[model samples]
Target: MSKSITLDQPDQRNLLDRMAQGTIGKPVNRLEGPDKVSGVATYAAEFSAPGAANGVLVTSTISKGEVALIDEASVMGMPGVLAVISDQRMIARPAQGGAGEAPVQQVKQIDYWGQPVAVVVAETFEQARDAAKRLKITYNADDMSDVVLNPEDADSWEEGPGTETVEQGALPQAMSEAAYSVDATYTTEGHNSAPMEPHAALAEWDGTKLTVHASLQMLNYNIDELADSMGLDAENVHLLSPYVGGGFGSKLGISPDVAAASVAAMQLGRPVRVVLSRQQVFQSVIRRTETTQRVRLAADADGRLQGFGHEAKVTNLPEEEFAEPVTQASAFLYPGQDRVLKVEMGRIHRMTAGSVRAPGEAVGMQALEAAMDELAEESGIGPVELRLRNIPERHPSDDVPYSSRRLAECLKAGAEAFGWDDKDRKPAQRREGEWWIGTGMATAARIHNLSKAEASVTLMEDGTAVVATDMTDIGTGTYTILGQIAGEMLGLEPSDVLVRLGDSDLARGPGSGGSWGAASSGSAVQIACEAIREELCDMLGCEDEDLTLKDGFAIHNNKRQSLPELLNGRSIEKLGKLKPGETEDDFAQASYGAFFTEVAVNAYTGETRIRRMSGAFGIGRVLNEKTAKSQCMGGMVWCIGSALMEDMMFDHRDGHLANCDLAEYHVPVNRDVPHLDVIMVEERDPAASPLQAKGVGELGICGGAGAICNAIYNACGVRLRSFPMTPDKLIDHLPEI
Candidate 1:
């Protein structure tokens, strides 16, 4: 039997106020609805005009080794073939104080599988693709190329933040004194974004200026990188990515497709369009690094953590680098006496891996949350209770007070909603014919990171407002949310507010990543609206404090003046930006969630299926409930994929990705997911930003996989350490009846 207790009364008035103040808590429709649904939204590959030249990218056959020869004559002689460009002469070394600063400009060494060997440009895409196949290239084989780091080889690799040459040999010493320790090694296979539309770019050069329609996350970053690669002035490059199918961090930088298209256009004196093939997409674009994490956790007798250590090694390009930072969130997520978070790197003959969704915490939470579940079981306490008991009121990293922390509230609410109190903690106690029933819980936390963003709001004579920013939507509802904010501030309906984004020429806002787009961009739009309101009051010569703007009309002395009449044919434009304030330094702001799952496991086969899953999110404020809920649901679906089927297999013997296509690498389909119950705990945190909203994008996926894993353990009396808790692994560990 279970008891339900409702501690806090639902405040409908407050909820309505939140919705009325802005679209901060409402479920407004997406602003780009018509564009997306009506097939009017132009993706990179669909922007081709007639007579545009085409370029085909050639990928390296071998994982490693230098290109021995490039015979381009046959490719050049092919019909409609314009030219063949390789690393031989056209690609120059980066110049000093030029655009290609950083690793983007660094060199011609073939460090990983799928590296670009050459590019074939022609009058038609078919001709270019055929020409690419005719190119002759040989490699000087190196046995050291296929080398992968193992536990025994861990010591041989250098330690640093993805750089070579640093003080090594720290893991052994740290693992020694860990009181309650679990020295478990976990591996996550490589995965690519595999967006529906492959990476494509259409570049046209009008002598001095170059314009590129690209598939990129950061338009400005792409513009700068392209300018540097082409040795042109940064001002000469104009990049646009109005719509992106999906990025998942793969589109963070300008990939070879963009660079190849630009170079081909420059050479042929005609516009060039380059679209990478599915196979080339697999090899050339960046993917999530295959990481192996060795984690050592030490906690006191009271289950209070004392020491935490994590070391991760990733397969990355010889020159391209990254630190998995798997131990980053561990420093502050829990209350600990001593914490050491060190990141190390290993060079492998693989594609360069970059940020994917939540870079550090996403993977870190997988190991950390699972370890927390294990520790809770070892302590003879429920997972939810253990987390509640160990909750920290402040951030451990800097001992700063939290502006708002509703994690405990979220846990309590989630437990009540999930019927946690009635759950059978004993493994294999409840059985339903061929299946065993079990329940599990896990918690997630994410820091709120908002950047300086600027937006221009123009109040037109037609009683409408247009908000323009360089922010990319990325399927996260930036377009809708920004329009909602502008609509509220300008006292107009959502339809009356037009939102323009994803062009470098617009008011520059932070590119949508790190879950900062909504908070940062919304705040910028708010500031701009405030400026416009102030300007309207100044023009009316009325006391700014005494005037109230509503329903597209300004009221002064019981007289209503329409915004269009007030503007008097001249558009009212105001630009505003939001910078980090002292509150950011004084207070730690983070979003928290409690994920609960109930699953059924087959007694004999150990097959597991999730019955129901619920997430109680305590993000500061819910901006557009429909979109936020969708984001959470999407993440949950992603978690379902990660928990059961997602993995990129590599042929360890040859250093090639075995499962490179969708047919081999699996994600969760509609059949895998059930209805996900999401509850948003609305709490306002002034520390996060003026919007009082935190990121909910990655938090939903953080601990969801672990929760499912824990549930499976309770159902079948099996403790599986590795991921994708497949049926075979579970059956092997199942106890005899």
Candidate 2:
């Protein structure tokens, strides 16, 4: 008597609003908060494996060419060096954004600098580190490598394979005849995600079956990837992440350390533990690609767009099939019939290039929105007014209508909250002592995605519900929000519902990236709860529509029945599966927001400090208020880092990362971040999901940096095109003022 609803079309039911339990949108604290704060939560390498040995990885010093020799005998006779493992079986780790599968290489070659070449295992970590330094590795270096570390040296370029060009209504005529236009190039340096926890792994081999604990984001994908890297079948390998401090996409795929640890464990007939040093984490992980974008905008006297052009140049390794999608939103960000766009991916060997945080739009919008600010100045229009004027009614490249868009609403609401109309319009107008004060704003947009997820919910005999899924929390409150969803649908409180996450043995989920984890996993929970409700309705002799579940009791026709009593001293288990439906094709969906920042700049020194920041976000129906705000605040912190001082510095001659540790590479500290506020708007997007919820995890970072970049111009009247508007970049330009 169970029921299921396929969300293949728009849904206006708003079922959660009618639920008797009111926990879905409440500001519930994270269910795992105590465990995390008390340090009882276990992460990778924390588990004490059986007879686990310690391994220290050795990385290559050369950029390219074969390993000329390895003096293995130099370290084997050392105090406790059990094994020095380097073979074709331990292949190059599969990078997430590169080819999904890594094939075994015949030659022991170094693809880039800092690549893992070998691993030394010993009884203790001290012996491993001490003996690893004793071994010597020689390489036949390729000094004539085509490794372009600097963008300026990349002279000749080719068009991106997937670039789209639009030529409608004569672009040359549109630009020539427009009343206002802006054409400029912007460059952004490469950066790292730098999550709190570094990559680590613990592996144990019971005969042929290998069990591993790694700090990875997606476990479902990792099981097969780790097996492939070790030349084992997926059935023989099992990985458990259970709890991840944070990944930010660095731990998406199986890194080399995971492979080396498994190899050492399999050869030595014992478990092996590998924990990356902070410097090694920076040297090995995938980083955000450096980008240079040229934007040309044509607008009428009223500030409405007439033409749009964006050409972006990004860099990646030759073997990688990925590049920074810098112009992702330009096709629909504005409606312009006359347009032209180009994208190029420079082949280079730097730190591995891939997704970090928001990936594409985080750096893309930094250039696009700043160009819009310049366009506004050229047109003598307010920054907010200019964005409101160019709000697209439909996808410009394609003729698709938006499923739901709230960009205009976000801009207006943010303006009202920040007192946009009453602010001084002149740059450096308001000065307090030696500091100049100014404010700026930018519109936020990110393409919302929907992925498939399967979850199982079991209603226990004691009137409790348990949800099982493989989604990792990644410090985003997945435990609390999933519990809330199940609690609202079933007749239970948030505390009464139990949630088990981060196990590959559980039902599959989207696994917490691209901001789609909550929607994908939550939809499965919703459907499973519905099935349970249907079974209960059949037992109560009433229609599911007429049933009301509240506080472990079912009410229909003014009659109440205890859930446990109706269960007949047994538990009922229900499984839910969610797949892509026709609803995604029916409408265009994206999360929209506006970010505003106030800054104070020292006139004498070229230093800038953010005074405060506020954001107005319209990301469908919010699951939990507290968690959503926390995500926004974190995004803004990354914004501050990007605008002030965050970059992966590289040596021009050798292509080696210069500052590979966090001590030299600065992120935001307590004093660096200031007061921040957020306003969450529930738009109730019927086309997004059955739960009517969209993603807000990465949207806040997409446009957060643009506001700070614009604020620098307002305070100092200097527009530094290059990223990380550092004091050196500003001081020279500020001498005229």
Candidate 3:
């Protein structure tokens, strides 16, 4: 049987709490951990097929132009070389995450410096790489002077084509009349997803059918993308992505490697494999848009906000619809009657800009919270107290009630836990030897989102259960959480629930993007288990609410029976579906949190070291504590990198990415990171999901960088309006000891 529900209204049943088997939110270890550690799991590039050849992509050397000639004869006679492919169906760029179709597929025209133009195939990986590098290619290059690399250059921008603007009142008037005000501009550099695994794919074509094992985040959408790119019907495609090393957001859609491998395999009548080099991954994959934001805040003497304004300029390729939504959370994050929020996208000849980790608020909140700190100083109030005074009761612009909120609780609890009172809050007032020590804090928020999802749950007569879906784990514990949800509802241990995932033949699931996979997919599993429970009730001749199930046994009105006895010789399988409805837009839904950090800055040199950090989050209900904490900790690590180290260096002269590998592009190492603490403030939000849970993967980084930035200011009395507060940007501005 199939069960379906569209969340038109809030579901207040809280059925998981009433379940007799207690495993939903338990801190159980990952079910796939042993396989992953033992090398028993297969990743995309690890799959083997008979007579498979290796393929390497050749990228354009010019920033802008069209391929004029490809001298295939130059590499045809090379040792171990098989063939060179320059097909018209080759994708120009990677599809944006969640984009249902492939990106424009005219590879002859190069839009960026490192756009892939051809693929070289050979019997071995080394021969393929060598032949690809030696494959002579010529381009009809555009004038270098015509390329627009700087997003803030007003003369070059194709302005406001995809701009988003919101206004409820006259922000200028309120700003002019306010007792205290702040207006500042902040700039952030582009960022990459930088997942541990580079993009890879193995494709095989058997006459009419095409099968691909690829590193992808959203298979339900990726199948359509791959099929559309190949000009084939969707039914002719099969995809398997059972294990993903990591995506962050880079693998959300089909990339060049997948397209190239598929084309190669179909042309040669054999299987082909393609794995992107690290530098290729950096230069060709999607990047987070660089932003230039102007934030304006108006407030009373008591630190109450009266007006708020956030205007930002972000960049993307010309004609591309995906623009970084830099002002996403500013509309309702704080209380202000007069508000203006705008995002103006500039068309540039850089790499395609799309979601990284937390697309909108990752960089947006860094500037917003810094401006809020300035507002606190201007209003002569403490930072935490100022924030407490400005929590909006409803959406400031939409006037919609919040489905659930814990911003206040998070701030209060985090402050208490981090010892907010036992600090010298004045800038440059505390010093130890040659280092200045200080503490700071900021609020975190990310918009809640949901998507259509479906999963199947089967209760076997052998007293075990199975859950199947197309959702990819991406190292986020999807395998464990789904197993836990099924085990809780069906009166079985998590160990006894077999979770099969990452195959397109299974029930389609909402893929892991925007942090909605667990809730959306888990809700489907929950609904399927609910259907099984109703069947068990029929067998016991009792109502669902009156039955108690635990330890593989069902009890109804004091009558207990083992599940194997109840099922006899048959197994029950049910498919459940979840779709978003009116409730998605009827209320303002978002995950809320707070971050606190302490830092030490060298008085002589501009070096800064984090001393300690803590974050408290309310993501509705946590499905698993261990995984949730790990995600938060990982996001906090991103916070450290974004605030001080990570930057994608793009040369404006030719739109070339200067730092195209991890060696030059820095991330926090173990030595750079300090001891960390995470607090999960659990709540029940019926409107969020059937599990009463919201997404938490991206929330930990929403405004976390601002806390580190603010702490730097408190330590050294230097305030930087740029991302990556490198020592050079701070040393000259530091106070004289």
lDDT of 2 by residue, 1-737 (tens): 23345668877888788898999889999888999899899989788976789999887787777898889899999888899988765654553433232322333777667777788999999999888888898888776455555667775666654555555667678889889998899888888879898888898998879988888777767777777677788789887887898888787777766888898899889999988888878887678888899988999989999998888998776666566777777767877888876788877766667778887789888888889888888888989888888988888877788888888888888888877752345676767887878788888888888888888899999899999988788888889888999999996888998999888778877787888888888888888998888788878899888999999998999988888888979887888877768877777788989999999888878898999999999989999999998998888899888888998898888878888889988899999999888888778887888788998888888877889888888887888788888888877776343
In model 1, the clashing pairs are none
What TM-score do all the candidates reach, one by one?
A: 0.91, 0.96, 0.98
Which candidate would rank higher by TM-score, 2 or 3?
3
State the local distance difference test value for candidate 1: 0.73
Candidate 1 has what TM-score? 0.91
Please report the candidate that would top lDDT against the real structure: 3
lDDT of each: 0.73, 0.82, 0.89
Predictions: Cα RMSD each: 6.4, 2.2, 1.6
Give per-residue lDDT, candidate 1, residue 139.
Answer: 80
| Tens-digit lDDT track of model 3 for 1-737 | 99998999998999899998989788989999999999999999999999999999999888888999999999999998888998876682333354532345368888888888999999999999999999999899998777776775645544444446888788899899999999899998889999998999999999899999999998998988788778888799999999999998888888889999999999999999999999999888788888889999999777788899999888887777777788889977987888888888877887777779988899999999999888876777888888889998888888899999998899999999998852336689889999999888899999998889999999999889999999999999999999999999999999999999999889999898898998899999999999999988887888889988799998888788899999998999999999988888889999999999999999888998999999999999899999999899999999999999999998878878999999999989999899999999989889989999999989989998999999899888898889988998988888888
Please report the candidate that would top TM-score against the real structure: 3
Rank ordering of all candidates by lDDT, starting from the highest: 3, 2, 1
- Point out where model 3 deviates above 4 Å: 92-102, 154-163, 422-424
